[model samples]
Structure formats: C-alpha cells, structure tokens
Target: MSTLQTSINGADSSVAVIIPSKPNPLTVTYKDLVTECSSFQHKLAAIGITNRSPVSIATVNSYEFIVSFLATSWQRGIAAPLNPAYKQDEFEFYIEDIKSAIVLVPKGAYDTDAPSVKAARKFNAAVAECYWDNVKKEVALDVKDLGQLKGHSKENILQAQPDDVALVLHTSGTTSRPKVVCHRSSQMSVIDVNVNELLC
Candidate 1:
C-alpha cells in the first residue's frame, strides 16, 4: 500500500468535502482540497514542522480541521486530533504525553486564551490558530507562539514514507492513564481504500 499523502489523488472537479453551515453548506472539490492542503503543508514546513513532529489539533469538525489534519500528514508529521471539549487538565496530559511540537486551534483561540493554548504554553509547545479566511479564500495558519519551533530553521517539505507514523490517537483513560496508539501511513492508506471500496 502507499502512503496517505500519495493516495490522496482523484478527479480534479469531484466533490471532496462538504461542511453544513447555517446559511449554506460549503463544498470543496478535490482540486481545491489538494491545493489548499499543499499550501498549508508548505506553511507547516516553513515553520519547521518535519517528519514525526506531533501536531495536536484541538479544533472541532470543520473545514479548517480537515485541512490542518491532512496538511500535517502530507508534511509527514503525526496528526494528533484532540477533543475541543477536553478540559485544561486533559489537554495538558495529552499535550505533554505526546510532546506535541505544535497545537492547532480555531481562529481567535489565542485572544480567548483557550485551554489548549494554555496547555501548549505550559509545555513549551508551539501554538497556532488554524481557520478558513473567507476573504483570503484559503486556510490561514496564524502562529501566536513558536515555542518549541523557536530558533529552529525552516524545514523542507518531505514525503510520507509507508512506515512513517501519520496519526496518533489515544484511548480514554477511564481506568488509568491514557494509552497512545500510532497508525502508519500505509495503514491509513489501506483503511481509506477499504472504506472507498465498501462505498463503491
């Protein structure tokens, strides 16, 4: 199997994502999705996000989250999706456990001094707000604090290897400390293929 990055190709004009909104639902074509993801990936690389860098994403289900998650993986970074509803302590635990290089939150998260932001700051992890700018017509990565990436030179855009860790998830620490799980690039690709096959 191939990596998720390499497998994310399709007919250009085909609908790749849709977000239901109040006034209208947003639709994204494969061309737009791929293009935006690559652009974001470049931004990530510019900020020193390299292979295996843990990128904790604390945004909810939205277009920004999709772009950030996909872009992180495309840049060969480990995407760690966190629940936005998580408490400060929970966020701190996860962020520290993963040694997250950066934490992505919704727009204005910095101004609000969000819990995720606080937790990231506490651990010296970088913090950035990820959001879709209607005027800019693209995803914006507003770096509030470079933290860990401070003084780190720009990183080159890297390709995802089949064995590279693409995603990191955790089990709810109901009884004890949460356990971490790593998913390889090849495994993600295979899962995507299987899901598509089932749909077809």
Candidate 2:
C-alpha cells in the first residue's frame, strides 16, 4: 500500500544521502531530504506540472538529480532521466518522444548552451538549471524558459495515485528506435513476490 512518497518518509534524523566525491563529503538527513523535496515539488506544481507531466532530467549523478526525480514522482509527474553524456540528437529523441514539460540541467548549462538545453529548446520544452546552491543551502531551480507552460496558471500540488505513471524510460534498440517503457507509481515498492511459487 506504500507509494514512493510514503516509503520515503523515514526517520527524520537518519542519514539519507552522502556524497563523498566533493572536497568534503556532504551528508543529508531524512528530514532535510523531505524538506528539500517538498520545496522542489511546490515549484513544479506552481509551473503547471501535474499528473503524467514528463520532466526530463539530463544531469549527472548528484543531489539535484535525486531531488528533482523524487519531486517529479511526488507530484504525480513522470520523471524521464537521460544520460548526461547523450548527444543532442539522442537528447532530442527522448525529450520529444516523452513530450517533456521541462528539462533540468546542471548549473551554467543555459549559459554554455549545453546539448540538453538545445534539444529542450528545439522541442519547445521548458528548460531549467537544477543545482545545489551553497549560499542558499538548498537546491536551486533556475528556469530559463517556460516554453509550453508560458501563460499557464499555477497548479495545485497533486498527490500520486497508485495507478499513475511515475516514470518513462526507453529500451536500447540495436535494430530500431528504442521502445518506450512506462512504470506505474504502484510499482515503486518494497515488496517482491514469488510468482513461480504462487502459480504452483
């Protein structure tokens, strides 16, 4: 019965994430994680991201990515994560196919005009830079363009339903275009059933 959002509500003081790659390892507790995710979720909903809205994430493994991914699902939106190393063509295919509402890139991506940013712009998908702001002590969402959401009214924060599609990914196709795979919100769980035994 637990959805991704419900499952994430862990002990407040427990460590949830640790990044040791930085000069100093950064640690985040469950309480901080929940607060950060809630803040980001509010930002998404305000921008008209609702159930089934696709939010493409094209950043490296980092705290910003994690927050955006979870927040997207929390808002009942689909989180389509693309490899940061993908080229513009690859990015375009995925972004276009998913019809992403917004694309989240790393800091300064808008200035450098990163491939992901260009692809998003080409598809008229909103583009934003997601990064950890040390000064603000939180993840920053720097929206460059509203794109499809221009003139869109703010949306209420939505709760995820068990049947909602929380994620959409593609299979690597050696022969043709990748196939789209949709993962339901209900699938984000801790249970693993023994199908073979049950069928017996």
lDDT of 2 by residue, 1-200 (tens): 66667766545677777766558877888778878989999999988899889999998888888788878988999999899889999999999998999999999989999999999999999999999999998998889999998888898988777888887889988899899999877786442121111112
* Residue 179 accuracy (lDDT) in model 2: 92
| Displacement of the residue 41 alpha carbon in candidate 2, Å | 0.2
Off by over 4 Å in 1: 191-200
Q: In model 2, which regions exceed 4 Å deviation?
A: 191-200
Query: How well is each residue in 1-200 modelled by candidate 1, as lDDT tens digits?
Result: 59877776655677777777869777888777788989999999999999889999998878888788778888999999998889999899999999999999998889999999999999999999998888998999999999989999999988889899988999877998889999898888864432223112
- For candidate 2, the per-residue lDDT at 17 reads 79
List clashing residue pairs in candidate 2: none
